[model samples]
Target: MDFEDACDIAEDLQFDLSGEELIDAYRERADAMVPGEPGRAVFLGYLGEFLAMAGRPEETRCLRGGGA
Candidate 1:
């Protein structure tokens, strides 16, 4: 998946997905997605926010490259 596609998926997952579905979206395309460093950071930030909203702060912290 390209950056645009990743962004699209992120946008969808941001509002609608949670738990396993959000995880599945990332796992499905992580190896294939090739967004740049900035893009990757932005995507991760989005994912972190999503995880937080989903009541998964530990996962969000991991996404933020932080320790528990």
Candidate 2:
């Protein structure tokens, strides 16, 4: 799905996500919907942005380390 469609879905979810978090969740859903697709990087980038926006950049970094 495109960014606009993702944004719409985020809005419908009513999660009170900031713009970055909304994009992040959308990317996560999109990536999950289509595994091994070329869009994974896009989703990852949005996830990083969301973490940073939420002041949880360390969590994001930790996730990249293959551990919880």
Candidate 3:
């Protein structure tokens, strides 16, 4: 998906993943996803959200590779 779409998903995740521990849990879940699967978007989306939650939005943007 696109950066904007990823950000939107991340924003939505803020409700359920409101704290650092929760966000880290989500990150671990995302990390467990297999590569080259349809879930990649979901993984990246969560990763982006985690970075943002962890005060690293720039890293999230960079991880997205472009179009942020």
Candidate 4:
């Protein structure tokens, strides 16, 4: 599926999605969401989860306090 479709399905298929799909979904989500304080923290957590889902624990490790 395309990035748009991947973004649409990333949530339900989080663990099942691939690297590019997860990355695209990550960017898609960061663009759509990313509020302040609590919401930002939550978004970062989701970002880490997305990286993990993409088999990219390295990227998550580099993210300080889940920051972008």
The global C-alpha lDDT for each of the candidates, from Candidate 1 onward, is 0.63, 0.60, 0.64, 0.59
Local error of candidate 4 at 17, Å? 11
Worst 10 residues of 1 by lDDT: 30-39
RMSD (Cα, Å) of candidate 3?
6.4
lDDT per residue for candidate 3 within 1-68, as digits (tens), equals: 44465456556666666667656655665566565545556656677766787798787887667646
Model 3 stretches astray by more than 4 angstroms: 1-17, 65-68
Give lDDT for model 4. Answer: 0.59
- Encode model 4's per-residue lDDT on 1-68: one tens digit a residue: 33444344456546766567656665565556545534344445667786787688877887654535
Model 1 agreement with the true structure over 48-68: per-residue lDDT tens digits: 665677788997776556955
Cα RMSDs, all models:
3.6, 5.0, 6.4, 7.1
* lDDT for residue 23 in candidate 3, whole number 0-100: 64
Tell me the number of clashing residue pairs for each predicted model: 0, 0, 0, 0
Estimate the TM-score of every prediction: 0.53, 0.48, 0.48, 0.45
Model 2 has how many clashing residue pairs? 0
Q: How do the residues 2-65 of candidate 2 rate in per-residue lDDT, one tens digit apiece?
A: 6565555545644666565575565567558565554544555556666677787785785476
Candidate 4 error regions (>4 Å): 1-36, 65-68
Clashing pairs for model 4 are: none
Q: Which scores higher on TM-score, 1 or 2?
A: 1
